[model samples]
Target: MSGPVWAPPEPGAVDVHTHVVPPATSFVERLTATDPRWARLVRRADRDDVADVVVAGRLFRTVRRVAYDLDQRHAEQAARGLAGQVLSAMPELFATWAPAAEAADYCRAFNEWLAEQVVGYDGFYCGLGIVPLQDPAVAPELLAEIGRLGLLGVEIPCATPDAPLHDRRFDEFFTEAERLGLLVFMHSVGSVTEFDHAMAGTGAIFPARIGEALAGLIANGVLARHPGLRLLASHGGGGLPASVARLDFVRGMAPPTRESMPEPAATYARRIWFDPLVFDAAVLCLLIELVGTDRLVLGSDYPFLPVDPAELLRDPRLPDGLVDQVRSENPRRLLADAPGTKHEE
Candidate 1:
């Protein structure tokens, strides 16, 4: 708890998971390029004037630019910032996410561009491909292209509000992902929509629903069948370890999920990896204790959550060397084990 609390992975150890929204891309680029003038501009723009929300409707009209400055220059700005941050925190690692929805062609363009723009940097970046899950038939082709591009994995949203992760339609996508040796990344909200998250605050904890869907997918035999396909849930799997019992208790009622595979709720934790964005030292310790260190990786949720991943790894609350594995080694293995990936850059 003394002396800087956490030192991010010696600059270049990639932060395995995070989101890149409009401003994030902007800020990241600005910071990475060390644009002093732009940095000062960002500093001034950084202040958020949170507006009042109507409690009943849960509506707020916050004033801010939704478009990121990075996108304007074909992400030239974002690349500069992200690359700098990766190098600054841990040059040994980087993060990845799938591209836009019209993936059949754009997916290829994005992946190739990503590899050329990012991964080709060699030790600078690696990526995952995003396919239009709405059209499963084309996914494999994109996955094939993703592999050809030397990208690391494919990112698919687990569930949207209209379609839960268990929706049979998504099964084909999972099957293809497994077949390609591509890992399935259930980006937290990918499992389900934010019906409850809208309630705000304290509701965020306890039986976190997103975590349950992730567990449900694994226990329902998704992971069982695709054992080789690396499956990871972002943001500490949205409280995965803690919700196991509850998930099991609910899933126990469904015979299909129960009979599919695995003995109990425990199987999901064993099969899937959880990113370290839980944001609590004690909770992180609990996750390691529940799922073991290998299943946990550093998901900084950077530029979003104020939490510093490097600091979480260094917390006195967890066992020694846990941080190193979470930040450096675990991700290395995750990317290493991913299929169709050629480990470019």
Candidate 2:
């Protein structure tokens, strides 16, 4: 811990999982005018450097300038020997509970703002915008717009308040995403509109929900239908590693499951990608064993999780060459073919 535990990988590495929030003042007026949901949430603060994020008149989290400051983020990543980061809006911004049109407008504006920020960072950051999945009809058009806006992909909730990732309502969006070869980054929310009131904010819902979403995607044949799609799950795919075997066993006993998946649960699991931000070396090893080395990448839920990423990567228990793969090679390869705006100076 005295010095950098792991040397920066050659050419530096790309962090595929990170988050950002636009300054509330940027859209608070339009949002508060139409959507009380947002009005009660992201009000403007007196200073740009700090703001309290309120939800339903309660403080959610305090955000700071680093959340959107390009120069500071660049220098911070550089200190860790990272060449760039893929920036996505925080999960709360998904706003699946809002009216479809309002959500779409917010997503479009946020994406445009994010794309502009990415361009301003030159090659230091890559943009992963959001789409209004609450309205399946509009989501695909916005997804195509994401590509045009020079963003690498879209970050979506692992499951909407009312629908799972494989719900047929969204098949069109996923279809267009595959056809366009865009990355689909799925993150789990700690609380959503549909969860039981008693279970809200218990903190266990996030990872468990990711596991459920993965199972739904596999069992309902989303991956089978969109073979070319690239999905990167946040938090190392939640509880999938420990439960995959049980899933395989259940699929074997259930004819419907077999009919949909055609392969073992693990087969479909391997087809998806995961970020190694599980916060434990043993868990990281389990994920590698489940999906192999090629599918793993660096994910520091940065600005929230304060641990030094290099220290996490330096664990001796990790397999030889695994550090370099996760820290440097894997993310670069995954993003190398992205159609987003070039980061080259």
- After superposition, candidate 1 runs with Cα above 4 Å error: 1-12, 19-109, 190-209, 247-257, 339-345
After best superposition, candidate 1 residue 341: deviation in angstroms? 5.0
The C-alpha lDDT values of all candidates are 0.52, 0.77
Residues 126-208, candidate 2, lDDT per residue (tens digit)? 77879988889999998888888778888999878778888999899999999888899999875644444413553567778
In model 1, the worst 10-residue window by lDDT is: 87-96
For model 2, the superposed segments whose C-alpha errors exceed 4 Å read 1-10, 33-36, 39-49, 192-202, 341-345
Candidate 2 residue 76 C-alpha distance from true site, Å: 2.7
